[model samples]
Target: MSNKKQKMDPRVMRTRQLLRDALVELIDERGYEKITVQDITERATLNRATFYLHYSDKLDLLYQSTKEILNDLLNNLNVTFEDKVEFDFSKDADEPHDTFMHLFEQISLNSKLYKVFLTEKDIPYFFSGLKKIIIDFISNGINFTQPDDKKLTVPRELAVRYFAAAFLEVIVWWLENDMPYSPKFMATQLMRITVKGPYLEHPFGK
Candidate 1:
């Protein structure tokens, strides 16, 4: 992050934003199938060379935009819980709930980018990136003590997968309905169900 890069000229930033905005607008208006690099460049008032300089292809641009948005979220986040937060269908913390709301606020602000990422063909890796974020957060937040407890039967992997899948489902639903509910409301709803699970006991607690 050089000073020059950080303080990119307003013109350059404006061009980049134009390119992204153009692509998103095109995708919304006509869908990805009918969109082309030339369409995006023409809409942005930039040439093909400029489009290439910013992104490799439409798919690349889509994913890059998503990655940039997610990076912005992860870098700015501050999730705090009181204890070893198990990656389970349990919800208990106000702070983590607040943090999730913040993340979704970021997501809501860029819903078009998300819709394109989710519905676009040949982009399972986008979901994988979302999973990785949850897994990484859970792994880092929960400290295991055993020397060989990498597989401590905490069901960490499955839990991470569950959270990712469930959360994404909510997000997709939100996008489909044009996000009628606030992000915080949706997140709090999720947290209540998820965090309440671990406290309940079954016959074998399975």
Candidate 2:
């Protein structure tokens, strides 16, 4: 596993990128379930044998592609928060934090693939992978031990799940609506919601 983290040969990396791009294009053109290994290799302009060198089958390609996407997200977050003492949302309006902006930018960059995956694909594996990534990110960044006056009433895990689910739904909605809002604006809105606690006052009575 450690060896896998080492830099890969440029030629090999280029080949894998081509294959991944081809898969994304094909998935967007048709659906993932309808695609085959031959279709991927043909679209990638690589031989079946070459495709086999990197992935066992179309499913293997899907798994590897999903893993790469999640890793990209995690890496961006790690780099953005590496030296920070706390999450900062007060940066200049034009200069949004990479940690927050990267998520929206990535989705925008790969909007076609994401739209297909979130709506057309029946794979639960992708959602599970994404949820785990979000949970890990929140778990690492947050101090679970609350201050005496602001104690959390819910379990840490439940809070994480609630936040993650809500965020995911927001992403889906944004994509479905063609992302009318800019990434910076979307990120700022999310930060605002997170920083401001939910309103709990009853409209009818105390």
lDDT of 2 at 39: 93
TM-score of 1: 0.72
TM-score of 2: 0.77
Question: For model 2, what is the alpha-carbon lDDT of residue 51?
Answer: 94
lDDT of each: 0.68, 0.72
The residue-by-residue lDDT of candidate 1 on 42-101, one tens digit each, is 998899998888788987777766676677656645654433345332335433455566
**What lDDT tens digits, residue by residue, belong to model 2 across residues 1-206?**
22564668878988998898888888878878788999989998999999999998888888888887767666656543555545454443334455667777777876766666777655677777777877765554344224233576777767778878877888888988988898878876765565454444645687
Error of 2 at 195 (Å): 1.5
Clashing pairs in 1: 89-194, 90-194, 90-195, 91-194, 91-195, 91-196
Task: Point to the candidate with the largest TM-score.
Answer: 2
Check candidate 2 and list the clashing pairs.
none
